[model samples]
Target: MMNCQFVFLLLVIYMLYLFVGAAIFSVLEQPYEEQLREKVLNMWDDFLEIHPCLSEEKLEDFLRTALLVKSFGVSVLRNISGFEVKWDFVSSLFFAGTTLTTIGYGHPFPISLSGKVFCVFYCLIGIPFTLSLLSIVAQKLTIFLRDRPLHYFHHRWNTSNNKLEWIHAIVVISILCLFSFFIPAIFFNFLEENWGYADALYFCFISLSTVGLGDYVPGERSGQRLPALYKLLVVGYLLLGLVCVFLMVEIFKNLLKHNQILSLFLLGYEAGRQDEEIDHVSTNDSEVPFAPRNDETTRRRVTHSASPNEKSYGSISPSRAPAIIT
Candidate 1:
């Protein structure tokens, strides 16, 4: 059974390899088809010249339009393969990495329908699964780290147990927000050297949110050249933002525990094991235990029965509370 599954997997892999290889070959061989098509058209034109009804100018225009359309298609194919431009090995690596990561960064986008379709499908299926898997791994890592809290735990041990600790967390988070968000915005704004701080902040917000509104792109402000540094910065910020968001959520959870305790106090509730018997008695008056005592019982009682914590309630009185039992 294992051998059969292995063979099946290998067969599937082989089929995928063949499909990819064929796609590449088709793209590469498209020029030959175009040449053959041109040759056929030239022959037809020769034949048409003997009995020409269409004007030369009109024919020329038609041919020009056809060539333009053909060029467009060819350009698209080349763009999808990342072949049109002369890129170094590092640049190619960056492109491939960003594409797979789904950050796409939009500096290098798919021009062809085939490329766009592949991107749509790839991101649709891949991003969620990848994110979910990463989240799971992060959660496990968090537990491991908590077992040994890094850096902050040592600081926490010496600090007083007060609101200051929570403030410390907020301060750290604020610093992170500044670096992860504000620094990039400042740099981009400097490059653009035109937009106001508000605009920069808006751009930063939109980018971090992954809304990609396209109203403002930082790299576009500067003419396109080695976008690698900017791309790396943006990708790094995105990744750090993700991790920071996770950390903040954990901090909020911890803070909420204190909120819960505060709520208990505000609501006049004691945080301890409650006497369930009191609850049962309060639920129904008919279920409350009663003992009848006449006037003779009140006169004969000489000993004090109530503890200092208990209030004495005389039996057989309309305004009387229930007699306290030891």
Candidate 2:
């Protein structure tokens, strides 16, 4: 129950963060969008005034086609006026977040040399920071789950630790899959004008895994209402999904730590056993065979025989001599 409450609190905090980001980006981008629209309209009016021979409808069609081309970062007719600003604050912020997370959704990118240089430095710092943060959070969340719910189940059922860990992992992973992937996919399906549930699910999976193929980015379609809000929510979903992925990884790590079946696949244990056997054989080979100690009579006979006053030691062996001290 405590764990459930903690989860709910985290959800609330995440929702609040999404809302705040949406509000800020909306405020920053809306004015720029409006200004750009006004500039385009003014250019069209000037064009119509200068080319009075052309009908307004034809002029509008030509300008619309030209604007479409401009959207793709190409300008076939350069003299025609259109607004082209890609690095507004909100887009830049979103790009930075995606880059740091390694999501790299290619909706927007740096085109200038200085901007590219800045991006290189930014990622060098950001990637490690993001990875460290993910690891720390993953560890804490795994410990919380293990100690609270997993412990409860283990003591109540008198189960083995390995079994309990597996049970805990399955339950937690199912919940994460439901919330982070399935539920968000449904939400994105509804919010994105062109995306179906399958596409949304694929996008969520790709973004969370940091594959970010860039084919199905959300909130960038034409005629999207409250696009900033949608983009912000997508960012929040990506972040939360990544956290759950990290949590799953940590849980699986704990499970593998005690899994006998998986341990059999490791060669380290075999290597250790071979080392022990080799040490045992080397120890046996190094041992010196014991010999019986010579008695005092044997020593005296050897010394007297070697003095040369008597027969040679070999010829006056103990077998040929009378029993002296004995």
Candidate 3:
């Protein structure tokens, strides 16, 4: 019952967060949306006046068709933006990547029946593959990046696990913010036309989070130089960025598992026990290539177990082993 309550509490918080986001976006964007609507209406009226032969209903139908094409990422405007092909090799690769990552940016979607059917099957297979890939990459990265290095320092410097965890959290957050967001945002701010630093930062955060709002996709403007290269780079960024996110999440989860008191408070007793069980499997999983317990760690544990401090400082309790969610 306590676990259920905790879960429900988390759900409520999540719903509240979503509602807050909806309210904020509505407040920010609705006025601009209304203004754009009125502007479009005025433009239509003026166009009808200038082109006296065109009927309002006919123009409306034409406008709808044009919008439909635009939604599929094809521009039909009168040579305002040059003909940018949506189905090129690079574009298809980017689309495929986004699909596998489950980003699902709203534009350039399939309108045809066959293409849509293919997309359904593609996602069915691809999303799992992408997830597995992310898991594998994260595991490999954590061994080199988090597990071994932290263990080495813990033994060599005689650092406590709690200190190491705090350091890991702060360092990882800073590094990810720098590489995954800040640096890329700087590049995007310069590269994207009419985009300010905030817009670029928003795009980076949204893309990395897999929100893919489609409000401000990079390299979508008119006559952009090296468009294919830019798109391919974006795909690469998504792949690496996702891996970084996965690694960061795994680290924080480990932090939580190691801090049993915090876990009990946050997850409740039943859920924390379940999490502990999962952590045992995670320890087993590490036996393959990048297990948290490297040979050095094992030797250190062996040496430390003979000491008087084994229970107090050397070995972590079975209940508090670092966990992965698999």
Off by over 4 Å in 3: 78-83, 258-262, 269-326
Error of 3 at 28 (Å): 3.2
lDDT of each: 0.57, 0.74, 0.82
- Candidate 1 per-residue C-alpha lDDT over 1-326 given as tens digits, one digit per residue, 9 for 90 to 100: 44445456667979999999999999999999999999988986896787588787787787788776544333323333342342444444444444544444455455579967977887788777755664665466555544244346656666543464466557756865787568767876776666777788787766555555556655433344446566565556656665555555555555555566544433222222243456665566433333234534433342223223333444344456476899
Give candidate 1's error at residue 27 in angstroms: 51
**Candidate 2 structure quality by residue, lDDT tens digits, 1-326:** 44445456667979999999999999999999999999989998898789899999887788788876555544455452322233555556677878899999766776679978998998999999997898788889887876688778778998988777887888999998999899988888998868989999998899999999888867555556666666676777777789899998887766766866655444335545777789897676445232123433333434432344444423455566787695
**Clashing residue pairs in candidate 3, if any?**
none
Q: Give the lDDT of residue 320 in candidate 1.
A: 61
What is the overall TM-score of model 1 with all chains considered together?
0.42
Best by lDDT: 3
RMSD of each: 20.3, 18.5, 12.8
Q: What are the per-model numbers of colliding residue pairs?
A: 0, 0, 0
Candidate 1 overall Cα lDDT vs. reference? 0.57
**Residue 218 accuracy (lDDT) in model 3:** 74
Whose TM-score is higher: candidate 2's or candidate 3's? 3
TM-score leader = 3
